[model samples]
Each structure stands twice: as C-alpha cells, then as structure tokens.
Target: MFKIMIVEDDPKIREIVLENITKWGFDGLGVEDFSEVFNTFIKYEPHLILMDINLPSFDGFYWCNKIREVSKVPIIFVSSRNTNMDIIMAVNMGGDDFIQKPFSLEVLMAKMNAILRRTYSYTSVESNIIEHNGAALNLKDSTIIYNEHKLELTKNEFKIIYLLMKNNGGVVSRDKIMRSLWEDESFVDDNTLTVNINRLRKKLADIGLDNFIQTKKGQGYIIL
Candidate 1:
C-alpha cells in the first residue's frame, strides 16, 4: 500500500484526513512532533506528503524547500491560505499541489487520487528503490539516501549510480555508462561522464560516505 504522510498542526483536521486516507485503503502516517518534522519525514519516507502552511516550528514552505533538496516525493500543500501568491509560492517551493482550507473531504480525496494516479500510473516498474552499501537510490525520483543524509541528483548522475550499484562489486566501463545514458537526450561525452562521476563522489562524501565508489583504473568504476 502507498504511504501518505499528513503534517497538519490541527489535531482534529489531521485525524479527519488520516481517517479518510485509511478508509480509502492507504497507509497514513500523522506527524506527532512538529519541531522534528524533517526527521519524521526521513523515517517514514512517505510516497506523498500532505503539508500545512502554518506549522509549529517551521512553516510548510521551509519544510517543502528542505524536502525538495533531498526528495522529489509528491507534496501537496493543505493550507487555509487561498491567495494567489500562496499557491504560486507553494508550487515554486516544490509542492505538487495545494488545497485551500475548509475543503470537503471528498474533494480532497479526489485531488489526492488524481495526483497519485498521475504520478504512478505512467511507470511500468513497481519498485523503484535500489540500495547498496547503506545507500538507497530512488530511480523514479532521482533521490539518494545514505546514513540518513538525503540528496537529489541530476538525471545523468542518477543513471550513473544506478548502473554502478546494479553492478556493485563489479567494474562498469566508461563506454558502458555512456551507452546507458540517452544519446538524443543529452550529449554525454567522455568529459561529461567524468564530471558527473566526480560530482557524485563529492555528494557521497558529504554524507560521511567517502570513497564509497571506487575506481578500477583502466577497468572502470565499482562500488565495493
């Protein structure tokens, strides 16, 4: 079942939303600690987030930006604010959709279902997670996690990691990596591949996982 996280401050509203989500055959996780919402978010790893604008320690905008840095998990702002600027800001800050306050539960469910369908229906694969050496990469969204530090990666970077991790403990040649990337999508030359590998290595190092990916000299790269 898909996991949905509700981050509303109002207890009554939060409960009501969760109840509806449960009734609809989804697993719903309600936020218990407002001050540590990010920690809770990392723990739950919900497929979708229902965020409120007026949070306790930090507003939804702040949390949205934070989450965007690490994830592309679909976030829909559930706020009382209906101003044009609020909606625009929410979208700009990585929120997938926004619902105004006092909305009917039915309407909310409809929107949620629409977003869920639109998000997952296009994919042929059911599972998108790839894990190696305590690092997990979400192929669907290009998000990576290691030792609780999350990072969003570019398309080429994601492909590179996916290839290496899939062949963990095995060497993947540079030419093979280039062939895996789309030729028409972008012109990935030898230098471009090296740049992506270096950037990925730096990102991994920032998360306390230095040298996670190893070089095999002329052979290629490996994650041993």
Candidate 2:
C-alpha cells in the first residue's frame, strides 16, 4: 500500500487527514515530533508527503528542500498561507502541488490519488532501494547502509557507487564513469574521478566494507 506522511502541527487536522487516508485505503503516518521531520521521513520512506507551511521548528519549505536533496518524493503543501508568493515559493521549493487550508477531505484525497498515480504509475516502490552484498543504497536520500551503519554520500559518490553496484561484478570503465558524471552536469576530469573513487572507497571501508570495489587492472572498476 502507498504510504502518505502528514506533517501538519494541528492535532485536529492531522487526525482528520489520517482518518480520511485510512478510509481511502492508504497507510497514513502522522508526525509527532516536528524537530525530527527529516529523520522521521527517512525512517518511514513515505511515498507522498502532506506538509504544512507554518511548522514549529522549520517551515514546510525548508523540509521540502531537505527532502528534495535526497529524494524526488512527491510533496503537496497544505497550508493556510494562500498568498501568491507562498504558492510560488512552494513550487520553487520542489512541492508538487499546493492546497489551501480548510480544504475538503475529499478534495485532498483526490489530489493525493492524482499525485500518487502520476508518480508511481511508472515505478515500483522497491526501485528506490538497491542492495549489493548486504549493503543497501537508498537512491532517495543518497545514503548507504551496511552492517547497520548508515553513511550519507555526496552526489559524486552516490552516482559512482550506484553505477558500480547496478553493474555488480562487471568492470565499469573510467571513461563510462566520467561520462555518467558529465551527464549529471558535474564536469569531472580523470583526476577528479580518481579522487571521488578513492574517497568512496574510504567511506565503504569505514562501514566495514573493505575492498568492496575491486580494480580490474587497466580496464576499470568493479564490485565483486
């Protein structure tokens, strides 16, 4: 079942939203601690988020940007602030849609369903996670977990590891890796690629994954 996370601070609204979400046959996760919204998000890995603009610690826009840095999960801003600028800011911050407060639960459900359909119609939930040799890489958050130790990865590190792990046991040439990096709009030369590989290796080693990536002589790199 698709899970939706509610980040509203009002108890009444949260309760109502949760009820309607359950009624619509979707699992609902309500946030109790506003301070750890991002952490809660990582823990649950909800498919969609209902965020309020006037949050306690940080506003919805801040949290939205934070989530965007890791995952492209669909976010809908549900807030009382209906200013034009507020709506524009929501979109600028990567929110998929903006719904004004005091909205009909039915309309909310409709929007939720629409976003879910458009977002997941082409992809499975498991596609966001890739695992290799007991190490799981979260494509959503640019983080990898091995032996219960989680390490956040930089953009370069993530792309490099993702390619290697996806093509597990096969040599990926340095040229191919550089091309991938270039495709990501990160212009990295041969030396930069080497630097990124070395750093990634050290991070893997830190998580008890020593020598996880093997060098294939003059061909390229491989994860065996």
Candidate 3:
C-alpha cells in the first residue's frame, strides 16, 4: 500500500481524509505531533502529503518549502481558507493540487491517485537501496545495511535515518526534521523527538556507526 501523510489540524478532517485514503487502498498516517511536522515527514517519508494552510507556529507553506528541499514528494494542499491568493500561494509553494475543505472524498481520492501514479506508481523506486559508506537502505524493502550487518528499522526510524543521510554534511533544521515526523508541528513535544533521536542513535551505535550522526547546538543534526 502506498503511504500517505495527512497534515490537517482538525480531528474530523484528518479522519475523513484517512478514511478515504484507506478506502482507496493506500495506508494513511495522521500527524500525531504537529509541532514536529518535518521530523515526522522524514521519519515516515510518506509517498504523498495532504496539508492544511493555516497551521500553528508555521503554516503549510512553510512546511511545504522545507519538504521540497529534501524530496521531490508530491504535496496536496487541503484548507478551509480557499481564497484565490491562498490557492496561488499553495502552487507557488510547490503544492501539486489545492483541495478546498467541505469537498467530496471521492474527488480527493481521485486527485491523490492521479498524483501517485504520475509521480511514483509509473516509476520504479531508485533501486530501493540508498547507501552511504558501508551503510545502505533498501527502499524496496525498507531495510538498512552496515558493514555486512543488517538492521531492521521501524518505518519511522528508517525515514529519520534516511533523511539525515540524504542531507549528509549539512545541518538539517529542527523544523525541517519535525515536518517529516508529524504534520502539525504545534503539537509535538520536545521530549518526544529527543527520545526518538536518542533511540535511533543508540541503534546506530549498536551497529558500529558510532558518531555517524552529529548534532549542531541550537540547530539540528547531520551525517558527517
């Protein structure tokens, strides 16, 4: 099943979209921690993202720009603020489609399916094996390889590590990281991210990848 990320703030809307997505045979993930949108995005690496315009802390446009920097993933804007300016801004921010709220779920699914087919379904994955140094990530199977030692990762863990490796040698901002983790960046607790990162680091160390990840004080992390 294709994985999809939903970034709506309203519980009802989030559920509605997820239901439709699931009905279309796509696995859906709703952002639990809005405060860490980018982190969740990378951690989950959803095939497509559904975003709301008006969000706490930073809006959808802000998060969209962040995601665009790391991946060519498709983003569909879903918002109640359906002004011409908003729609135009959504496109300018790299959204593939603008979906105004109070719309039919069927139409939404259609748009989503079309985007997925054009962007990924018609194209094979990039060998699924994303490698660096002695470490490699099997995108096809979602696995990791390091020094001939295999490491099985949860979907969240794999996405986190993949984004870090993709942006190696550069400090990826915390906001950027959060977006990958959760759709609503306003709801994520700082401790939650800390715990996940700490756990990932420990796992890497277990595989002899000590210090493979470096932290920049007040910034984010990088794979140096």
Candidate 4:
C-alpha cells in the first residue's frame, strides 16, 4: 500500500486527517515524535506527506525544504495559516499542494488521490546499475562496484551510498541522512545516526573504500 505521512501537531487534526485519508482507502502514517518528522518519513517511505505549517521546533517549510533535498515525495501543506503569502511560500518551499484548515474531507481526499496519481503514475523502474566516477551501484543486487572491487551493502547502506553518490561532491546533511535511515518511527537521536554512519563507514573501509564518505563538520556528509 502507498503510505502517506501526516505531520500535523494538533492531535485532533492529526487524528481527523488520518481517519479521513484511511477511509478513502489509502494507508496513512501519523508522525509520533514531532522532532523526527523527516526520520519517520524515511522509515515509512511514504508516497506523500500532509504537513502543518506551525510546528514545535521548526515549521513545515523547514521540514519541506529538508525533504526536498533527497526526495521528491509529494508534500501537501495543511495549515490554519491561510494567507496568500503562506500558500505561495509553501509552494516555493517545495510543497506540491496546500490544503487550508477547516477544509472538507472530500476535498482533502481528492487532493491526496490526485497528488499520489501524479507522482507515482509516471515513475519508471530504476535500472539495476547507476554509475559515476568509475563507481557502479547495482540496485538489483545492493552492491557498489568500483575499480574492479565489489562493495556489498545492506539496503540502508545502499540507499545512503546511492543518495551521496547521486549528489556527488555535495554534502548530504545528517538531517537528510537520518530521514533516509529511520523515516518510519520516532525521532532518530543524533547519536543514533552517528553510530549508524560510523558503522556504515567501517563497512565501506572493510571493502577497501576508506574515507569514501566524508564528514562535513557542522554540516552533514559527502562522497568525495
């Protein structure tokens, strides 16, 4: 089933939306730890998201920008803020659509269905091997081949490597990385990500790819 992640903070709205969406026959995931909205998203691997504008620590715009960094998951902003500027900014910040609060259930369901169809209706299957800089990632086999060396990878490892390699020479921030690793559950603590990344790097080192992924200090990580 195609999953949809909802990031609304208000429990009433969150519950209502979840009920409405599920009643429409699509699976829906409610964000538990508001702090790890993106993290939950990566784990759920949702096909779309329903985001609220005002959040506890960060606004939906900030989260939307973060999600756009590594994914094109369809985001539909759902907020009580109904200014034209708010809607415009939502769109500019990578929201695919915006639904104002006090909206009809039918309208919300319609928008959800439309966005899902539009996003996935045209997605083609990825090729087994994606290559660059003499490196090849076999999607079918979950391995990275480079310089006649084959580096085996777990699914998460392959995805992390795929994202970094795809955005070669560019820093992929921890927020983005954590989203990829644990988008399904509660917040992914910083130390948790640190541990996984360290483990992933050691695995790469085992396969002779020492320092293939570099730390970016106050920023994120990169494949340099």
lDDT of 4 by residue, 1-224 (tens): 67778998999988988988787777988886877775565456678889999998889999898667546778999999999999999999999998888888889888988887887788842334555555566666687755445677887788788888878689998888778888753565679877777888997777667888899899999986
Task: Judging by lDDT against the true structure, name the best candidate.
Answer: 2
The Cα error of candidate 1 at residue 30, in Å, is 0.7
**Root-mean-square deviation (CA) per prediction:** 6.5, 8.0, 15.6, 14.9
Which residue pairs come into collision in candidate 1?
none
The CA lDDT at 29 in model 4 is 84
Q: Identify the runs in model 4 with alpha carbons over 4 angstroms from their true place.
A: 124-224
Write the residue-wise lDDT of candidate 1 on 12-49 in tens digits. 99999999999999999999788767767766778889
lDDT by residue (tens digit), candidate 2, 140-209 = 7899877557899998899899999899678999888898887753555568888889999999999899
TM per candidate = 0.61, 0.64, 0.59, 0.59
Q: Which stretches of candidate 2 lie over 4 Å from their true place?
A: 127-137, 140-224
Question: Which of the two, 3 or 4, has more lDDT?
Answer: 3
> What lDDT is reached at residue 84 by model 2?
97
Model 2 Cα shift for residue 148 (angstroms): 18
Of 1 and 4, the candidate ranking higher by lDDT? 1
